[model samples]
Target: MLHIEDLSYETGGRTLVDAVTLHAAPGETVGLVGPNGSGKTTLLRCVYGTLKPSAGQVRVDGTVLDGAKERARRIATVPQDGQSAFELTVREVVAMGRSPHKKFWEPDSAADRLLVDEALARVGVTDLAERPFPGLSGGERQRALVARALVQQPRLLVLDEPTNHLDIRYQLEILTLVRELGTTNLLALHDLNLAAYFCDRIHVLRTGAVVASGTPAEVLTPDLLAEVYGVRAEVAVHPATGAPTVTYLPGPRTPHATTAPASRPSAEQKTSAM
Candidate 1:
């Protein structure tokens, strides 16, 4: 389980994550969603231990995260943007996740290599294992990064924009795999439909604070969508899966712009104007 208690991160007197509290039950897939610059990435960074929270505490399975190595053992994170200048091969990158389990300067054992290979195959990147990380396409890189995280086999997985470069097919495939991993997952996703499809629960963030959190059907109402995202959207149920489906229209309101109508005018309005 992952638990965040009143977590906040501030710098230069500006708060990026504001007193956010949430939890993911064991083996649950929880999603974090917000518009661009809503502090979703910043909040994930705090959980990943790269950026320490200015206030509040983060605990995974009752263990308080204090340092890099300890946190690495408990949480495996696929960052929004990975450092691509390492000049490492895909297999090498995935192998690096095992570092936390090994002593300094120790070489990987046979079992470690087997786990890496399994992770590569699991994410459908086994063919790219020998290829250089920088040479692969964006979607390929994302899968490779996921493979790395899986090999770590942490109690919790933290991913930011995991489907950023994936095609529709891979997006569904990877998310399905994540759900079946039997581990706690906290991901930041831009695709509302994917979040609704995969996450057991979702926490919506706006302006560095959590505006709502609940099951997809419970929290993804049209009113909340309009208020938090400033977009005209509808929440409906999927026919096959019976899950929430979100449809976003073009019209939206901005703080500086007037609110768009909930629904567009009918043909009669245009004919009368003409």
Candidate 2:
């Protein structure tokens, strides 16, 4: 399991993330949802070891992350924007994930190649394996990146906005693929409906803290939506799937007078309005 205890991050005397704690167990998928600037990405960064927490510990399998390189190897991350500077083919990019398993200056072996191919196939990007990395579309590139992470064979996979630039089909495709992998996953997502449908549990962050953590049915109430997002919405179960569905309503509108000119007849006003 991946465990975070009292995690916090500060920069320039301002706290970006407060004392927060969360966890993801093996074979579980946890979704993180919040409004913009709520420190969802920051908390994920801490999980992937990209950023150090100012006042907490990130532990994997009972080992503190700071002192555990092996534990770090068990964690893999896919960030929001999938950009790479290497002028390599998709196969080469996916093959790179095996570096964590190799010794310094070691060359890629046959086992590594097989794993890379498997990972590419797993993400449904095997057909584009020979294409140049920079030539792929946003959705294809995202899949390639995920394939790279899969090649690492991590116990915990952390993704930040994995579906940010994708279409609806790709969004479902990616999350479904992740779910099928059956690895421990922690994903930061903006689409509430997707979270409600795909996540086994969810952590709702608001202003650098986790305000709620539970199953979708327990946490995604209309009151929580209004309190956290400042929007009025109707929450109901999907007719067929029985999953939670949220329908947003427009905010209160200003009252306007419907006064007609003296020259214009009242009948004209009634007909024109209709």
lDDT of each: 0.86, 0.81
Off by over 4 Å in 1: 252-274
TM-score of each: 0.90, 0.88
How much lDDT does candidate 2 score? 0.81
Worst 10 residues of 2 by lDDT: 256-265
**1-274, model 1: which lDDT tens digit per residue?**
8889999999899999999999999998899999998999999999998898999989898889777899999899998757688789999999999999999989999999999999999999999999999988889999999999999989999999999889998998888788778889999999988887788789999989999998877778777877888787766665555567777777544323222223322324422422
Clashes of each: 0, 0
Estimate, for each residue in 1-274, the C-alpha lDDT of model 2 and write its tens digit.
Answer: 8788999999899888899898888788899999999999999998888788899988878777553357447888888877777778999988878877788779998889899988898888989999999888888888898999999888889999899778888788888778778789999999998887777788999999999998777777777887888887777766544556767778753222222111211323322322
In Å, residue 199's CA in model 2 sits off its true spot by 0.9
